[model samples]
Each structure stands twice: as structure tokens, then as C-alpha cells.
Target: MTTAPAPPTLPRTTGAPVPVVPSRGAGPTRLRALDGLRLLAALMVAAYHYGGRDGEIGDAWGSSPAYQFPTASGFFAYGCLGVQIFFVISGFVICMSGWGRPLRAFFASRVSRLFPAYWAAVILVTVVFALPWVAYEAVSPTDALTNLTMLQMPLGVDRVLGVCWTLWAEMRFYALFALCVVLPGATRGRVALFCAGWTLAAVVAEAADNSVLDIVLMPEYAPFFIGGIGFYLIHRYGSRDTAGWAIVVVSWLLGQHYAVSRLWHPADLPDAFSYRPSLGIVAVITLGYLMIAAIALGKLRWANWRWLTVAGALTYPFYLIHEHLGWVAVHLLHQDLGLPAAATFPLVLVAMLALAWCLYRFVERPLTPRLKRAIMR
Candidate 1:
């Protein structure tokens, strides 16, 4: 079964004010509350990583008697759902902003926003992790150059920074979005087109057992991006109808209970767990649709909600640095602190917040724009 796409939180205009930046800043951007959503999503991802990477939750969830239950497994294996939310939000915003900009301008802005911080993180990872283990296996100059250029994935190269995979994916998405902008008739359909086309592709992908499209030209995770696009379109043009909501809710329930589990795993399970036209997947997609609708149609003011937005603003850095370091920190502290994962989760969260903020204020913010200028020149 296909996974449900994420809900759109990007704005759809009803004569409301919104920030009009270049590509990827599209839809309604003044909705900083979505920033909060972004932050929340990133944090959830961080939590999942912290537990899983340290072999705490995965080991526990998979076998430990105390952590047998899904809920008790630690940050909810489902908490990784946050990544989908981020994708949905990114698609909506990027499509909206990039739609009107020239290709040169669009690419420049994206490169500017994305790369500097990434390079800095790479440098940090090398110094902290790579240098210490030089004799064990050092990063060759060629590998370093591959990573620096963000062509590591195509070359089948791994980075000193493990989290760089997502950046590679995001960069690919940007390239795809650029194609949409350049196509003569591409602007006409907007979200509906993206959602329908992605759904069809996803169905085909499932049949082919081909995951390559997603990593390349295709949206690696169509459900999330399509979900975001679907929500954005509905907010702009669809009615305040409850029909879509019904589909979304049902899909959400079904997906949680059956689809996500089965979709992610089938070989381990019997024929009973094999592919079926899951209403649960549809429900999940529909739910995302409703969320996007709520944000886009509701009002620009709606996006300005507090803490989540603050978190959203910090999400990128948090995501970039948190996993490896935070995972190590949480585990080393877990036994010593004698705290349950639940009790200790918030401390990890706070530490991530602090570190992310410091990275932004000190490393990313200062260097990103300057790097872009230098590169584009």
C-alpha cells in the first residue's frame, strides 16, 4: 500500500498578506506557526535518532521485554513521521516560491540557503570524529571533495557527516522543482497536478519494486510532498468541505494500524501482510490534506502561532547536528542519570535546541549567504 502524503501548511491566498520571496519561499510564508510545526517535526526525528542510533529503542523495541509494546518503545518508531511532515511543508513552500522566479535566481537562493551550513557541519564532523580515527580510516581528499560538492550520492560516496543524505535528497527536489518551473505549461495545474502525478508514480513504483526514481528525478517520498501540495491546492481552491476530512481521518487510522506497518514490512510477514488497496493510506493522505487546508485557507495570521514556529526556524540546524552527537550523549547519560527514557527525553530535546541555535547564530547564519554569493559569482 502507498504511504499517505503529508499535509500542507503553506498558505493559499484569500487576499491575505504573505511574504513573497524567491523560489521555495512560496505559498503563504508569513505563517511562522508552521515553523513551529517544522521544529516539532525535526525534534521528533531527533528523538527517534537518539534512541535508535544508540541501539536503545531499536534493541529494546525489537526484543526487550520491558519495551515490547509500540508506545513504550521510546520516541515512537512512528515519530519518524516528522520527516514526511517536513517534506510536505518543503514541497508546498518551494513550489509556491519557485514558481515565479527565474531559474538562475531560484537556484542561487536555494544554494545560498542550503550549502554553507552543510559545509560547516561537514568540517565539524571531520574534526570531531574523523581526525580522532585517522589511523582507523581517514577521509581521502577525493571523498572529501565528493562530499563538499554534494555529488557523493551519485558517486556512491558516503560522507563523514552521515546526515548529509537528506541534504542530497533536498537538493534533488530543488532540481526537480526547477524543471516544473521551466516547463511552459507546468504552472497551470499547481497542487492538484503534483498530487495526482505523484500518486500515479508511487503506485507504479510499488509495482516495480523500484526505489531509484524516488532518489533521483522522482520525489523520493512522494506521499509527503504530494500531501503538502494537495493541501495547498485545497486551501486555495477547494471548499471547506468535510468530505476530504473524512477520507483523511479514515486513511490516518488505517495507515497507523495496518498500512505503515505492512508497507514498510512484508517479506518478514506472511501473504496476509502483502499489498492491498489500503484505505488507511488514503486516510493518512486525506488527513494531511486537511492540515494543509487548515493552514492555507484559514488565514495568514494562523501561521504565526508561537513556540512551534520558533522551533521551525531552528529545525534545519537541529536536524543537521543532533543525530550523531545527541545519540551518543543520550546513551552515555541514560544509565548514569538512572532516568527512564521518557524523563530523559526532554533534556535531550533542550540540548538539541541549544546546539541548533548556537549553530545558526554562529556558524550557519553568518556563512550561508556569503557562501552563496561567492559560489554564484
Candidate 2:
């Protein structure tokens, strides 16, 4: 659900870099590579969930994840950094799509794009868990309804899908950006100011112990999104924009600090691996930032393959259904069907991918246009 608020982006027009970014109602050239990168980020998160985790399975596995796949668990542990990657990409894509559009267009795109697939996934996962063969307890109807609104986090309701905390973060970012920046005009001057103000507020939000501020400001995640917007600015404005470079650098520094702090003192996730958290965290997040910067600078424009748009379309649905449903599938296959972890993992992943494609093709594709027209009207 953290995918951008735009349609499948158009192919990049071949030419030398245009020094001047079109400011009024003109979007930047479609970076097909961003689509592929988003799929990579989603897969990274999937790896962390499938391969990195342990002990929280509630007997979902015969053996713990670490014991089930000892060698691979070490590597997959670092995949938790994928959420940070998604936010950075979200920042860039949201900025690109939001530029020069009216508030209505922005609203329609986000609502239409996110809700259809999310609703489908919520129903699918909820029903799967409630099956007679599945051992998991289903959430109450009240919570299920709230989850549909995608505001379950702030309201203190549990998420139907565990991964949606990131969506809550994405929603807050969009809400603030729409109200504070896009609603007004989205000029270069205005966007820069929005970044500046958000950054400052985030810093303050970090220093305080206020839970409300933490949730609202998301000091932990603001930098990645801010950095993404900065990268978009660089893409739009050109290489000479000192302020754009500064935003990316500062956001990167803050992101490194926040990431290191969060990942270092982590406890409670049993057998989660001791993979040199500090060094590995820095390297992984640095990779995300560098990828965005490379795209903005047009260094990776050659990734315009036709298949990436399909990959990007599957990201949201795959992410939505992957967590609990995947756990159940693995348990069903490995424990009940007597499949090995090696086969079960790949099988479940493939099954989820197939389901994602089905939902994207049949569910989201059909619902998006009607949703857009209803809202746009």
C-alpha cells in the first residue's frame, strides 16, 4: 500500500537531461526502475517476515525459523530494513505524482489506488485465518471495519494485517503533505518549506516522550520520506540545487542515526539474529538512499523493462496478504502436508505471488476506475 499515487509511469523520454524542471501541471518522465525497486523492497520485507523471524509463530511451524533454516536466517535478518526503503521510495513517487496536480487529483489517485486492493486483502486474509483448519483467532468485526479505514493504528485498534503499520505511516505522510503542501500550490518554494518544517518538527518530535507526537510526526520515519522528496526535487530542479542536495544529506544523516538507534536496542523478537546490527543497518539504508539518488540523477534509466509495471502492481497486494496468510500457508504445507521448509517457503511465496497477481488483475484493476470516477465526480 506504500506504492506511489500515480498510474504505471510512462517510459522515460530519451534525451540529454533537461536542466529546467517543468513546474506547472507537468510530471517528470516515468522511471520504470522505481517500479522494480519497489518490488525489491517488498521482497526484502517478505524475506524478513518469512526467513528472519522466530518464536512468535504460535506453533505455526514445527521448528523455529532459525532452526528451520539456520544458514539463510542470518542473511534474511537484514531484510527488515526494507520498510525504510519503501518510505524513501514513497517520498520520491508521491512528490513526483503530486507535483502540479490539484488536490482532487491527488486525493482520487491515492484513494482509488490504495483502497481497492487493501479491502480485498483484508477480506481474503481475515477469511483465511477464520477457516476451520487454521488455528489463528480472528479479530472482532469492529476491528475489521476499522482496519478498512486504514486508521486502525491511531485509534488504538489492532491491524488486520500486521504489516500495515507502515501504511499508517504512509497515510500520515500523505495527509500532511496534501494538507500542508499540495493543497496550497506545490511550488518549488512551498515544497522546500514543507520539507524544512517537517524536518524541524520531526527533530522536536524525536526529543520528546509524547506518544501522540511520536505517532503523528513519525520522527523515526520522517527523514526517509523527506529525503525522498529532496531526491524528487533534485530530479525536477537539476543537479545545481544546493538545497536539494542538503535535504538529501541531512535526511540521510538523520535516517542513519534513527535506524541505528532503533535496530541496536531491539529485543522481544526472539531469535531475530545478531547480524552486526549497527554496521549492516547503515550499509542497507545507505543502499536505499543511493538507489533513489541514482534514479533522480538519471543514472539508472536503462531499467525500463516492460515487466516492472506488473511487478509494481503486485507489490501492494503481496505486502498486504504476505504476513499472516503466509505463516498459515507455511504451517499447512510444512507441518500438515509434510513438506520441507526449503520447499514450503518458496511454495508459499509463489502462492502469495499468484494470489497477488489475481487480485491485481481481477480485483484492483476493475475497482480502481469505478472508485476514481465515483470520487472524481
Candidate 3:
């Protein structure tokens, strides 16, 4: 049977088919590629969790030759890079859709889209873990308040959903960046200066302590957010040529290894600082900025992958529920079936995708439009 046609995206103030972006000539009428890229990223993440050894498993054959291959895990380990991709996409979408609009409308739109389902996930997980006879952390009032507000990141608190720390960062960036854009005299120059200062401060703070505040606001990811904004400007007034994208993509990939090596293993630095702690992450994010630039400039075709789009659409929900239920599923399956890592990994991944697709179609997409209308009103 043929699947029903996907719902049309609601038009934003900028006339784009989505929110959070300001389009000059109606947004790219074609985004199948970006959608596909997102799908690909989500799948990689699933693979990483199920397959990666040494990280969350022991004596589980995760250390086997096949599993240890760099190519196998590196691509997925880089799945965290999907966060950067999301940020860039958000920046473009928001800038085009919400920039220059009334703060009330913009803020409302964001709240309506992000919170309903996300909070639902939080509540679901909390309840599941809190059930009598279940193994779970004792829920505290502070934890409740923090998680509810998604302030766990800036407040330097432990994440309730664990994987949600990244969402918290995204939320904070949206709020902070929007404020910066609309502030009295929040011109491009001022915004640039502020972002630069904030990034530098985060680096300094991370150097002092690896606290949540430092990590959440660190300079490492600043460029990703900024790159989003930069992309908007390019879309608005600059060229959207493929040549530019090629340059950025090539430069980012070729330079990424050196940057990672320098940041994480600081060859020239003295032994006391050999582990230079924060640089590798920074380099990775730097690469992310370049990737976004490449996408915007049309250099990255991976975003054009059809499967990537399908997977990308489910990413948020998949991320939300996967870790919690995934652990339980793995535990039970491993116990009963004694499946090896390879088999377990693929099986769980397929299950997660099936679950995410069902939820997205039945829950998220259905509610999003109505919520958007209510918020816009």
C-alpha cells in the first residue's frame, strides 16, 4: 500500500514552509536532501549506541576486530556531529522564519513546537523509572524543576533524560541568540562581538572547570550557532553557489584531523598540559561550522540523501526515548537470547526506528500544526 503523502509544512512569516528561518525568495523549495541527511545522522547514532564497545559495554565482543574498525564507529561516533547539523538547520530556519518578527510570536512558536512532545517524553520516562519495584533514581524537587524548565544545562545540573543535555544547549542558544538579534541596538557588529566574547569566556571557564555551564556554553559549539546565523545572511544577500560549498567542505575535512590531533593530544605542549582537554571538541565543532557552510553553499550532498531525511525527521524523538528504553531492551534481550553485539545492535536499531516513525506520525506531526496555530494566535 502507498504511504499517505506527507503533510505540507506551515508557512512562516518569511513565507518559508517551516519556522525559525527568514527566506528572501521563499526558502529552498527543495529540502529532500537535508531531510535525508538528518535521517542518515539519526541512523548513525543508533548504530553507535548498539555497536560501540569500550564505551558502555564490557567483555561483550565490542572490542572485536570488526567492531574496532575506525571507519565503522568513527562515522557514527561522529553522529554527535548531527547536533551541529541540527543547530545549523535551526539557525537557518529560525532566522528566516522568526527573525525581525514580534518577540511574542517568535517565542510562542518555539515553545509550542519544542515543549509539548519533549515534556511528554520527560514525563513518560520519569514515570516509567519511578514505578514501584523499578530501578531508578529518586526524583527530587530540584531535579523536577530543572528538568521541567530544560535549565539543566545552564544550571549545571545532571540531565534527567541524559541525552537531553544537547537539547538544553539548543534551547538556550535559540533564546540567547534571539535576544541578541532583537536587543536594542543588536546590530550584526554588536552580535558578533558578543558571540566572540561569550565564546572566549566559555573556553576560559572550561579551562578552569569542566562544569556543565562551561561545557554547555563552551566556545567549541559557538561557531555552529554562529554559522547558522551566518548562513541566514548568506541566504538573504549572498551567493548560494556550489563552488563556495566545495571550498568549505574540502577545507573542513582536510583540516579536521590536524585540528583534532592538536586539540586532544597537543604535541607541542608540555607534559603538564599534554592532554589539553577541550581543544579536540572545539576542533570537531569547528568542522561542524564548515559543514553547515558547505551545506548552505551546496557543497555537501549527503544532506540530499533520501534516507537521511526520513531518519532526521525522527531524530529528536528517537533521541528522547531510545536511551531509556534501549537500555532495558538490550538488557532483556541479552539475558534471554544471549545475542552478540553485532546482532543485538542491528535488531535494537530497527526497533527504535519503527517506534520513532510510529510516534512521529501519530503524535508529533499531528499535534505540531494545531499547536502552531494556537501559539500564533
Candidate 4:
């Protein structure tokens, strides 16, 4: 899943009591709690991919007596929901950052924040895993070129890395949100209109059974993003707005429907596992909503430790490279060389974190400003 860069803090407002709705110039305040939450979500995804059933390690170990860990059964099973958490967080952060910005500024900010780290991860994964692994073929020159644009799937090319699919969803969300930025006035009203229009389009696409429209509209995932927008509205403006509350309620109901459908979809269920849609799925959806709710309520404001923010910064790069690289490490050490899972898992995590930090420090931090300057010029 994709993670956004930390949002720049909005300047503090003074005089009179804080308004019910943020003024156009009102900036977003730093929320430390959300940073901690982001790190937890990233780790959850990593744990899910590494230890859950159908995971690389799980498939390799396969009911062996030596492979059992307490965490392997319960929470980790639901870790895939971390991607949903990311979508909600993305919506909240994007709304916070782009609230009063011009369309060109919003676009420039997104490209600079996303592209530098994304390009680094794409290249690193291609070199480290894609080329060396016998199981996966090296990316073709055309695919490599397409991947660099980060629009490979939309452009009718395959993703060079499996996890990059989330980036496409993020790109779509950004495109949809840009419409509000370009509107003439009342940012919140414009956003509300966009959400209402998009949700209507999603309903129409579903009714028509149009796969192309469904893909373009991304009706399936719209709820999470809309839910994020709802949380932002509630945060910036009080819960008094009837229209905002209605949007939140409708988005949530739709999101739940989409979640249930995916959980029960034939393609998603494993043949050996007689999976039923159950409380586990509900819990995942509920937990994601609760996280955003907490942010809206200021419950997580105290979570802002410097170290937590540092960890949050690592999330994007760690998420980018973790799955395939971890799988490769497990294959070589745990399966081929017979290293114990206990040792191998930690080793792989440490290596992934080290690589992530290197990418962040060397590529993301250094290149982002230059790229932003170049783009904004």
C-alpha cells in the first residue's frame, strides 16, 4: 500500500474562539497520534504478508510443528486490512494538505512527495528481486519504462512490482480530489459535490455492470477515501453539518458492502480454506474507521513523539520493498539453507528496515526538494 509524506504543519490561528469551520487560510495542525498510527498500520501489513496463511513464510512452513507462533493465527490473519487503513489515512492527509491550495500547487506537491521515493523503490525492487529470482522474470524494457511513469496498469502494462497496484488507486484519488481544488469557491462544498457525484457514478457503474467504468470510477474503494474525507470534515468543521454526516454514513455503508463482497468473492477465497464472511472482516473495517475517528476526536494527539514520526517516515519505503524482498530472503535462508524461522524473520525485517532507511535518506529526502523545484518551475 502507498503511504504519503508527512504533511507540513499549518500556521496557528489566533484571536476569537476557534471557528466551527476552518477559514480558507486555516492550516492543519501536526497530529503526532496519526504518525504512530501510520507506523502500526505499515507493520501490520508487513506482518500479514510475512506470517499469514498464503504468505511466503506460511506457505513454505506449511503446518510444520516448528512453524507455529501465537501471532500467526489471530491478528496477523487480518493484516491485509492495513491497505484499507492506508486509503483512509491518504484521504485525511490529502484533504489536510490540499485544503486551500491551488490546483497546480496541489499537483506539484503530490508529484514531488510521491515520485522520488516511488522511483527509488521501483528500481531497487527490480534490481534486487526481479532480476535475480528464478521464479519471476526480469521486467522488459517497455514494462520498465511504463513502471517509471507509475501508470503501468492504466496504460495497459503490468506492474513491475506486485505491491505497486495500490499506487494506482492513490493516483485515482488524487485526480478525483484535484477537481475540488480547481473549483471556484467553498472548498468543503466543492469536495462534497465531488464525493456525491463520484458515489453516484459508482452506483451507476455497478448497476450497468460496466467493468471499464468500474475500474475508472474505482467504486469498490471509494468508501474508504470518502470516509477519510468525512473524518476531515468533522475535524475541520464540527459534526453539526447534516450534509457531512450524511456523506459519512453513506460512504461507510457502501464501504462495508464492498468489503464483504471482496471477502466472499470466489477468486479471493483459497480452495483449501472454507472462508466465511465473519466478524473478522467486520473488525478490520471497524478498526480502520475507529483509527480515523480517534484522529478526528483528538484522541491520538498525544502520540506525537519524535521517534514515532521517524518511524512513520520509514513506512513508505519499507512498504514498497518488504513483500518481494522478504519472500526472496525467506526462500534463500529459511527454505534453501534451513535457517530457522525465528532467526530468519527478524533478519529479514532488519534488512528491510535498513534498506528502507537508506532509500529514505539517500533518495527521498535528497531528491524531493530538487524535484519539487523542477516541477514547480
Q: Report the C-alpha lDDT of model 3 over 235-321, residue by residue, as the tens digit.
A: 443454333233334334433443354335443655321132344455555755655555554455334444544555666677676
- Please give the ranking of all candidate structures by TM-score, highest first, separated by commas: 2, 4, 1, 3
lDDT of each: 0.54, 0.79, 0.54, 0.69
Indicate the worst ten consecutive residues by lDDT in candidate 4: 11-20
Q: What would the per-residue lDDT of candidate 1 be over residues 88-169, giving only the tens digit for each residue?
A: 7776666665554567667766776666666766666555545552222436767876788877877888675666766676
Better of 2 and 3 by TM-score: 2
TM-score of each: 0.71, 0.90, 0.68, 0.85
Q: Which is the better candidate, 1 or 4, if ranked by lDDT?
A: 4
Q: Give the TM-score of candidate 3.
A: 0.68
Better of 2 and 4 by lDDT: 2
Best candidate (score: TM-score): 2
lDDT of 3: 0.54
Which portions of model 2 miss their true places by more than 4 Å?
1-29, 56-58, 266-276
lDDT of 2 at 21: 30
Model 2, 1-377: lDDT tens digits are 12123333211100001112332244644466777888888888888888886654536677667888889987777888889988888887787777777888788878888888899988988888788978888888889888999888888897789988988898889899989887997877898899999999999987887888888899999999999999988877777777889999999999999999887645455654545358788999999889888888768876767687677778888988888888898888988999988898889889988998998889987988798889989
Q: What lDDT score goes with residue 140 in model 2?
A: 86
Evaluated at residue 188, the lDDT of candidate 3 is 41
